[model samples]
Target: MDRQTLDMEGARRGEISSASLQMGEDTIAVQCIATMSVESMEFSPWETATNKRAQSLYASFFVINLFFGLMALAWGGLFPGNGSSFIALVIGGVLTLLGFVLGIRAAMMARRMKRRQPYYRLVIGASDGRRIPLVDNNRDVLMRIRDVVRHKMDSGDREIRGDFDLDLDLVNLNLPTEAQKAQTLSRGPDIVPKSRQRETEVEAATAETESEVLFDQDAEIIRDAS
Candidate 1:
């Protein structure tokens, strides 16, 4: 049989295994093989709209606050009457400061959300043109899958015939050293009063027995010499 046919058979039988191997002193590579069907690909319109709406809301609030603050300050400066001028100035200053803080915080949140949002999703396209979702909502993973799909399409391979293997290289496995392992083992259980007493007694008995044996050996040697 041809190699393609063998691979196809393996995929159909779900015979692929996932494993991890140490590639270097600090690097490890994980290999996984799976049979998957790609249905369709599209960007998320809903997510884009939601992001834009949130950004707009924050921007609108900031602009409104800033405009009102400026107006209050202008009124206070243009028309100084009794204590009304002081009140207006204080209100305007507080509002402007609040608006500035809010604007900054909103901008930061929007940027963070944009970074986290996944723009693409993979769907299982059915014969009827219906698409079903697959995989988690992660932009990086989706981008990688998109690249693979594009490559396959560009190569004119329309059909997937066999098991697909994915190799992921990971750095800093963060494994413990031998000394760390020994320390961890040594601290396995706390020494209770009963256990501590038993250990001390065992040590004392062992030392006494050893000393008596040494004394007996010495006496035998002296008798022989005499």
Candidate 2:
């Protein structure tokens, strides 16, 4: 019969849709949100790519080249008088440079992949018990939920309730996915082809010329009548 009961009924049917957080008379206290932070978690170097085998192969190349190059250099240093010492030095230097370049490439790729991933977390501390946690990948969705709960808290709502969906491990963070980027590009303003634009200009020019000729003919007939 009251507002609380109505909200509860709506929640039961999943009509109240937003992030996973639910706030109402039976939910956790919004004031319990003691800390809020945006964080990032890195994907493992091996697990960061669609092509796992390629990633593994590159890593192997880095290790193998570096190891062999160092060994060859050591051999050259220990046997300077040997006939092959100069050859060993040359091969070692080239291989070492190649290995170093590969290692740098791997490091840069890892950093880039990490930048594409992000996490949004909310921590709530209960006055009477353990802390509660809510995590989501969508920054906008999470912020909206937080604002709603905070509004209720600021308005002196003591009987606050909060619900969270803890199964968020499979959810990915908000980023411009390749598909989304392509979709956005597709929505850009339509551009007229150059040929079509040229045709329109020519039609306007012809219309203007015809109008000028008609005006000249009317003037000549008026003069002859005078």
- The whole-model C-alpha lDDT of candidate 1 against the native structure comes to 0.50
- Model 1, 48-164: lDDT tens digits are 455667667777888888989998999899999757989999999988888887788668656655443222333334343433333333445434443444444455443322222
TM-score of each: 0.35, 0.33
- The parts of candidate 2 lying over 4 Å away from their true place are 1-48, 117-226
Best by TM-score: 1
* C-alpha lDDT values of all predictions: 0.50, 0.55
Error of 2 at 137 (Å): 10
lDDT of 2 by residue, 1-226 (tens): 0011111111221112222333323344345545444343322323433534454566778888999999889989999999999899889888888888877876655554444334455544555564444445555655654565565556754333333332332222232345587888989988899999999999999999999999999999999999
- Which pairs of residues collide in model 2? 27-160, 27-161, 27-162, 28-161, 28-162
> What C-alpha lDDT, on a 0 to 100 scale, does residue 65 get in candidate 2?
90
